[model samples]
Each structure stands twice: as structure tokens, then as C-alpha cells.
Target chain A: MLELLVSGFAAIFTDPLAISMVFLGVMVGIIFGALPGLTTVAGLSMFLPVTYVMVSHVGLSMLTAIYIGGTSGGLISAILLNMPGTPASIATTFDGAPMAKKGEAGKALGIAVFASLVGTLVGVGVMIFASPVLARLTLKFGPWEYFTVTFFALTLIASLTGKSVIKGLLSALFGMMFATIGLSPVDGTPRYTFGSLQLTSGFHLLVVLVGLYAIREVLLTASSKQEPIKVLKYKMKGLGFGLHDMAGNWINLIRSSLVGLGIGILPGIGGSTSNIIAYSVAKNSSKHPEKYGTGIPDGIIASEASNNGSIGGAMIPLLTLGIPGDGATAILLGGFMLHGMQPGPLLFQQNGDVVYSIFAAMVLGIIFMAVLMWSGMRMFVQVLKVPNHILIPLIVVLCSIGAYALGNRVFDMWGLLLFGFVGLMMAKFKIPAPPFILGFILEYQLELNLRRGLEYSNGNFWDVFTRPISGTFLALTILSMVVTIINNHKASVRELKEKKEGTA
Target chain B: MNSDTKREVQIGIFFLVLATAYIIGTFGISTFTPFGNRGLDSRSIPQLIGLLVIILSIAHIAQVLLREKQVKALLENEQEADTLVCDEDEVACIQPVKGTIIERLDRVFSIKLLLSFVYLTLYIAAYQPVGFIISSTGFLIAESLLLVKKEERKRWRTFIILFSIGASVLIYFIFTRYLTLFLPSGILG
Candidate 1:
């Protein structure tokens, strides 16, 4: 193991091509993440094909680097423009934007970068040691277990759906319905193609994701006025603060990292939920909870740390079980498959060197993410100064290029537009998009596993309960829904009481 | 109804209609083998999803209606209070671009949005025929110019045109030449 680790480090650093690609990937990822509507998923999807010609290690390293940088890059816009560059950075805006407004943008950025690096290191450490064991353990999992785990993962819709669980479920079901459009997993029968050849292929994840995030954003930007951001005059003073600040938040950092890693290991949830969950946990557990969401570093640390930590955590399942942790990892899965590298327990046994090389690249990527983000802090802050009129058009052109380049089919462009409209309507209707995305990604797996489970059980649906793991997950799903309902009820009741008190 | 409630109602109705279409679509799907195939058929999940959608949509519509009624009751009780009082607090809290609720709603339906969507539609339509370069260049220029503030449009005119053309050429070269990804060349090929 020691030799493998040493060789892995040497492989990335000794090879000039690997080092350069890693750096380039990080830079591209940061830029994409810094730009609102261009997410880590989009970056991965766009670059997946580009990596086809390159060797497996170098290409996979590049993709992994992008994931790390993109996950961290959201803090730039979150702090400066009060707009999260990626879903992972959503919670960053809670305190980050306020801190920026308070003229502590430099400090916010510094803390975010530092925490993200720390989170990445911790997550990578766990992935290196824990993945092999987890993979070995999960090797025992049957179709029933897979079905149950997926069911539990889908229950993460509870965490994502803001204010309305019903709307969230609706969105998720809608996504699953869309996924069911193509050929069936079991019988190879056409489901909902409606006689259209394009429909037979189904909607590409890229088309839906780009359309929802990028195209919808373009439309939104066009409809809104470009509010000029008042850039604060602040000195770049050596990562903005002393170690004393971080010393007090060791527990917060560790806790958030664990939260991120745990959530990331979950099949469907990733940084999108991890950041929010970490922020919530941090706030809930804070000595001075009131100080949260009011321009505090703890909130920023929690948000950045958890989201970045999830980068490594997300890789665990992908590397081990051939199950992608989230949308970005789903693309990464495609990248691996494109390179003819199937990730599973056998992967470690067969291609241990490649796995180690990826680990080495990830460690290097984290370092680059921290260093480059720190060095480019000044320029990234200036990114907010670019008016929307200029940025929006460039983004659209890129999005169009990305959609068209996927298959060189004009139909995808139309799909992009159609889903863009769907995204817009979703926003207008206050239905969350993340659940929908997760549902779509998980649909095929869910259906396949369910059918397989049934086949194994000889058509007995109750056989799921006979298997402990599947039964546990199904129980958790029910519990999650119930808890969500109760929590929402309590929240609404509290709000009503507050309103009544105010009226009185 | 309040605008928010109206929006929710529209969404509910949309889902309800979608549910109907899904059910119909599921029925149209070719089931093929009559028996002995598998545990669950292909159409089963879609049908289940369609039914779930119908139930969920109805429940959502009810929830929205109930909220609307409660809000109306609250509004009746607070009839003396100005309607904008709540809005003012939210607006102040958000400090959104263009401030005021009415202004934001106006912006939502702005001519720029209509023009942008229409232009995008035209661009997509023209993409294969007119080529990526021509259509993209044309789009970047028109969209950029359309979005720029009216007073600044003239000042930024030459820069916009140059930037649009440069961006188009650069993107074209990067994708086609470097990445080796085949983009629509049309006549330009």
C-alpha cells in the first residue's frame, strides 16, 4: 500500500502531461464553478468526450480535478455576487454574501478556500482507506439491497424540496417519468417514445441539466436587470486571517467534513445537500447560533468544507460499487466507461495502479484548488464586475456548443430549449430541480434493481422484507417521509404562532 | 387569487394534464409478450408514476387552495393594513435588482425576455442550415446588443460586434479543430 501510494504520487508529479492536465482541469472547473449556471456536472459532461483520446489515468485525473475545483469554485460567486456558482455553494451565500456585503469578502474567500482544502484532504483520506473495505462489504449486496438503497437515496428528496415535500415528490416523479421514456430495462420494449426516433434515445442527462441550469439561467438573466455589484476595496492579506480563527472551529470543520463525506457516500446525495446539511448542523450545534447567517466564518467554513469533502466521498461509491454518488459522478462514471474502465471491486484487484494514480491526482488537485483559488482571488472577485449582458451571451453560446457537441444533433439543442422552459416553469412554480435531477439519474437503476429483485424472489414483492438491507432502506424511506412531514408541520405552526404574536 | 397562488394553481393544472398524457402514453406503449416474461412489465412503473402524479397534483391543488383561503381570511382581518406592508419588508430584505414587487414582475415579463427567447428560437432553427458560426455570431451580437442598456448600446456597438465574431471563430476552432468534435458546418464545411 505504501509503495502504491508513493508510486501514485510519483506518477502524477513525475509525468508532465498528468500535472498539466490536472492544473488545466482545475482552472477550467474553477471558471465554470465561478460562473452561475455552469455547474460541475456541465463541466464533466462537456469534457467527458474531450478526454476520450487521452490515456485513462490522465483523463480521469483531469475529470477528478475538475470535480474538486468546481465544487470549491462556487464560493467565488456566492460571496461576491450573492449568487451560488453551483448548487454545492448554495449555503455559502447564506453567510458569504452577507460577509461580502460587510466588506469582508477577502476574509470569506480565504476561509472558504482553507476549509475546502481541509475538507478535500479529509475526504480523500477516507476514500483511500475506506473504499476498499466498503467495496468488499457491498460485494455481498443483492438486487434487493440495491433496490432498497436506491429507494432510501430517493428519499433525499425530503432534504431538497424546499417548503413543499409534495412538490418535490412531484418533480422527482416527473423526472423518473422522463427517464422511463426510452427502452425498458427488463424487456427491451419501448415505453414512451411516441414513435419519435429521438425519443427512443431518451433525454440525455446533459440535455436536461444544461437546459435546466444554463438555458433557464440565460432566460432569467435576460428578464432581469444587471445589478452592478459594488466591489469592496480589500487587501489580499495572506489568506485573510490567522490560525487562531480556525483553531476554535476544529470541531465544526471535522463535523462538517464527516457530514459531507457521509452524505457523499450516499448514492444520490452529494455536495448539493451536504453543504446545506452541514450549514444547518453547524448552525444548530453552534455556541452562538444567532451569529449564523449574519456574515460569520463558521457558516462559510461549514458550507465550503462539507461541499468539498463530498468530492472525495462521492468518488468512493463510483470507484467501488460502480454506482455514481451524484450527477457529477454520474458523468464521471460515463468517463470511466468511455475509457473502458469499469469501476467495481474487481477494478481495485485488476487495476489498482490506475486507482492509486487517481488518488494521487486528487490529492494534487486539492492542493492546486487551494493555491490557484488563493492566487486568483483578486481576478475572481473582479469576475462579478463583468456585466450580465456580456456574460449571459457567452454562456449561452457555450451551452449551445456543449449541447450540440454532445451528439452533433440539432435535436439536443431543441431538448435543451424545451427543458430550459421546464426549468423556468419549475422555478416560477417553486418546485425544486435537484430532486428531479436525482430522480432522473436514479430511475434506471431503481427500475432495474426492482425488476431484478422481483426476479430473484420469484415474483414475491414481500421478498424485499425477507432481505434485511432492502427492508431497512424501505423502512428508512418511510421514516424519512414521515419526519419530513412532521418537521414541515412544526415549522408552519411555529411561523403561524409568530405571526399571531406579531398581529397581537 | 394572489399571483403566487395563481402560479401554484397553474403548476398543479399542468401536472394534472401531464398525468393524463402519461397514462395515455403508457397505454399506447407496446407491451408485446402476454405472459411469462418478468416480475414487472415496462409499462407498470410509468403507469404507477402517472397515477402518483394525478394523486399528488390533486393534493397540491388542494394545499394551494387551502393556503389561498387562509391568506384571504388573514387579508380580510387585516383589511386596514396596506397590502404593500408585507411586500415592503420582503423587498427590503431581498434588496433585489429593480426593487419593488411590481417592478420585478414587470421585469419578469420584460420585452428583453421575449426578444431573447424568440432570437434563441430563431438561432436554433437557423443553426444547422446557417451553420454554427453564422448563427452563433448573429445570436451573440443581437442578444448582447439587446441586453445592453439602451444608453450604452451605441457606445458598446463596435466592441460587441467584434467580440461576437471573435468568440464565434474561437469556439468554432476550439471545438472542431482542437477537440475534434464535429459541429454543424453546413455550407461552411
Candidate 2:
């Protein structure tokens, strides 16, 4: 493993184009992440197809670089604009905005950037060690195990990541239905292709992604009126602050990073939820909890670190189990498929060199992300001033280029618009998009494994429950749905009582 | 009911209709049972998913109806019921439009959103015939003019025009020349 990893670093260092591509990815990612509407997922979705013409290792490395930079870049707007650039940085604004108001904007940026660096390193470190062990554990898994795991993941995403579990499940089913449009998996039977050759191949994951995240985001920004942001001025001199600033903060940093890692390793939740969870956990553990939202470095550290940490946390599942933890990794799984590789237990044996190179690129990308945020802080702040009017059309053009590049067909571009409308409707209806995305990505595998499991069982559906691993996952799925229902009922009843008391 | 609840009910009905259509569509899928009749085929999962969605959608509608009734019952029995006034602005905004459903479609799809969609559709429609450079340049100009403030557009007009032309050409060269990707030249080639 160590030898392969070293060779991976050697491959990156040997290829100048790969190194520069990583740099470009990080720069592009930071720009996307710093802008309030464009997110890390959008960055990956738009760029994933652009990498189709590159070598697998170089392309994969570049995608991961974008992931690291985008996850860390949200602090820029959280501090300056008070609007979090991405959901991952929602908790950053709690202290970041206040700190900016108190004229410690530089101090806040400095601490956030540093914490991001540490968090990413922690996540990357664990991923380097953890993926192989997890992959090995999953090596013994069969069709039944795979089916149960995917089922469990779908239920987890549906229940955990949204306001309403039914809505989440419906969004997921909608995605699955869309996935079934093209050729049916394993059997080569066409399901719902209404005589169009383009429909025969179904919607490319890239088309669905670019449509849902990037194009929908553009339309969303266009429909809503944009308010002019008051740009805040700040300075960073010699790493902004020092080791003295980080004094007594080692435990908070470690604990938050671990919290981020834990959430990242989970199937449905990702960095967006982890940062907030880590911040709350930090607040609960802090001696002066009330000072949390009132211009403190503690809040900033917890947020930036955990979100960055989840970057690595997300990779662990993506690499080991071939199950993406979030939208970004789901696109990455698409990237891997585009490159003629699937990330699973067999990936290490087949593509050890590519996997190791991705790890190496992440380590290097984190360093580059921190350096870019500090040295290029002045430039990124200017990015907030770019009006959405020009920005929106430009993004549409760029994303259109991506959709077109999918099969060098104009059909995918139209598909982008169709899904974009669907995405917009999903948002308006309060149906969560992440579960929809994950469900779409996993639908084929779920069906494939289910059929395979049935074939293996010789028509015995009860065999799934008889196996220890599959049965446990099935039981947990039932437990989560039941719990969600009970909690939802209690919540509505409580709301009713509150309403009654308010009227009385 | 408040607009928020109304929206939830609308969402519930949307899913119910979708499930019914999906289940009907599942019947059209040609099943291949190479592993014998007992083994699940192409239509099985879709059929199962369609049924599940139908049940869930019904459950969602029932829950919403039951909750609305509970709240209504509580509100009617309250001595201070007059204090629980609805948000007038929201109620006025969501009130059914005074027209046929087809005419009311405009209420849901805003002009800006509709224009943007049309612009995108036109741009992609021209992508094969007019080429990426020409179509994209036109899209950027039209879309930017629509998005930019009317007053600001007059000042930024020249800049937007130049950027549109420059960006499309630049993107064309970069992808075709360096990335070795095939982009249609259409008549321009």
C-alpha cells in the first residue's frame, strides 16, 4: 500500500499536465464555492464530463482537487457576505459574520482557512488507512448483502436528510423512475425508450447532474432578485494570526474533525450537515457556550474543520464500497464509470495506481487550497462582486458545453433543460434533491442486486432475512422508518398543542 | 388552509398522479425472464416502486388532511379564535387565479423563468445548425440582456457583446484544440 501510494505521488510529480490540472481544478472550485449560488456539487457536475478526454489518473485527481477546494472555499462568503456560499458553511456564518462585524474579518478568515487545512488532513489521513480495511470487509459481500446495503442507504438518505421522510422517499422514487428510462440493467431490455435513439441510452448521470444542480441553480438565481452585497475589507498579515490563536483549541479541532469524519462516512449525510452538527457539539462542550455566535474563533474553527474533514470522510465510502456519500461523490462515481473503472474492493487490485494518485492529489490539493485562500484572499473577495446577471448566463453556457460533451450530442443538452425544470419543481415542492440524486445513481445496482439475490435464493424472498448482514440491515431500515413516523406524529401533535395554547 | 398546507396537498396529489402513471408505464415494459418466471425481471422493480409510491402518496395525503382537520377543530373551539388570523398577504397571493387553468399557468411559471427556458431551448436547438460559437454567443447576449438591469444593460451593452463573442470562440478553441474533443462546426467548418 505504501509503495503504491509513493508511486502515485511519483506519477503526479512526473506529469506536469496532471499537476497543473489539479491546480486549475482547485482554482475553479474556489471560485464556484465562494459564489453563493454555485456549490461544490455544481463544480463537480460541470467539470466531470470535461475530464473525459484526459487520462484516468489525472482526471480523477483533478476531480478530487476540486472537491477539497470547494469544500474549504465557502468560508469566504460566510465571513464577508454573511450568506454562506454553500450549505457546508452554514455554521460558519454563526461566528464568521459576527467576527467580520467586529473588525476581526482577517482573523476569522485566517483561523477558518487553517482549520480547513487541518480538517482535510485528518480526513485524508483516515481515508488512506480506512478504505482498504473497509473494502476488504466488503469483499465477502454477495448479491443479498449488496441489495440490503443499498436499500439501507436509500432509507437512510430518505429519512435523515430531509424535512419530511415521505417527501424524501418520493424524491428518491422519482429519481429511480427516471433511471429506469433507458435500457434495463443486466437484461438489455429497453424499458421506456419511446423510439428515440437518445432515450435508448437513457439520461447520462452528467446530464441529470448538470441539469439538477448547475442549470437549476442558474434559473433559481435568475427568478429571484439579487441584492447588492456590501463588500467588507480585511487584511491578512503573516498567516493572519499565530499558534497563540490556536492555543487551547487542539481538542476542539480534533473532536470536530472526527464528528465530520463520522458523518461523512455515513451514506446519506455529508459535509453540509456535519459542519453544523460539529459546531453544536462544540458549543455544548464549550465552557462559554453563549459566546459561540458572538464573534468567536471557536465557532469558526469547528465549522471550517468539520466541513473540510467530511471531504475525506466522503471519499472513504466512495472508494471502498462504491457507494457515494453525497452528490459530489455520486458525480465522482460517474467519473470513475466514464474512465472505465468502478470503485470497490476490486478497485485496489485493478486500479491501485489511480486510487493512490487520487489520495496523493488530495494531500497536495489541501495544501494548495490553504495557500490559495491566504495568498489569493484579495482576489476571491473580488469574486463576490461579480453580478449574477453576467454570471448566470456564462454558467449556463459552460454547463451546456458539459452536457454536450457527454456523447457529443445535442440531445443531452435538451435533457439538461428538462431535468433542470424537474429540479426547479422539486425545490418548489420542498422535495429534497440529494436523496433523489443518490437514488438515481444507485437504482441500477439496487435492481441488479435484487434480481441476482432472487436468482441465488431460488424464489425464496425470506432468504434475505435469514442472512445475518442482510437481515440486520433490513431490520434497521424498518426501525428507521418506524421511528421517523412516530417522531413526525409527535412533532405535529406538539405543534397543534402549541397552536391551541397560543390561541387560548 | 394556509398556502403552505395547500402547497403540501398539491405536492401529495402530484405524486399520486405520478405513481399511477408510472405503474401504468411499468406494464408496457417487456419482461425478460432468462432466469425463469420466478426470477425478477425488467418490470418487477418498477412495478414494486410504483406500488410503494402509490401507498406513500396516499399516506401523505391522508396525513395532511387529518392534520388540517385537527388544527381546524382546535381553532374553532378556541375562545380567542379571532386572534389566530391567517397571513393575509400569503392568503391573497395563493388565492386561485380568476381565469381558466390554462390561463393560470402563467401564474406558476414566471416570465423571467419562462424566457430563460425558451432562450436555452432555442440555443440548444441551434447548437447543431449554427455551431457552438455562434449559438452560444447569441445565447449569452440575449440571456444577459434579459438578466441585467434595464438601465445597467445600456451601459454594459458593448462589454456584454464583446464578452459573448470572445467567450464562445475561446471555449470553442480550448475544447477542440487542447482537449481533443469533437464539437460540431456546423456550417462554420
> Which is the leading candidate under lDDT?
2
lDDT of 2 by residue, B1-189 (tens): 755667778888998898898889888899888658766889988998899888988888887788888888888864432222222111112335479764455455555778899999999999999898899999999999888887788998999999999988998898899888878887798
Candidate lDDT values, in order: 0.81, 0.86
Judging by DockQ against the true structure, name the best candidate. Answer: 2
**Please, what are the lDDT tens digits per residue for candidate 2 over residues A1-504?**
889989999998888988898998898889888889779878887677579899999999889989888898899999988988988999999999999999999999999999999999999999998898888888988988989988988988898877788889988898999999989987888888887788999999878877987888788778665678887778789688889988878899999999998899887688899999999999999999999999999999999999988988988988987888887888788889889999888898899999999988888898889899989999999888998888889888878887888788999999999999998878767688888888888899899899888888897889999999999999999998899889977887889889888988
Which digits, one per residue and each the tens of the lDDT, describe model 1 over residues B2-45?
65676678888999999998898888877744556565888888
In angstroms, the error of model 1 at A357 is 3.6
Best by TM-score: 2
Model 1 achieves a DockQ score of: 0.45
Residue range with the least summed lDDT across 10 consecutive positions in model 1 chain A: A153-162
Misplaced by over 4 Å in model 2 are B77-109
Q: What residue pairs clash in candidate 2, if any at all? A: none
Query: Candidate 1, which segments miss by more than 4 Å at Cα?
Result: A1-11, A35-49, A77-108, A237-240, A265-299, A317-327, A330-356, B34-38, B67-76, B80-108
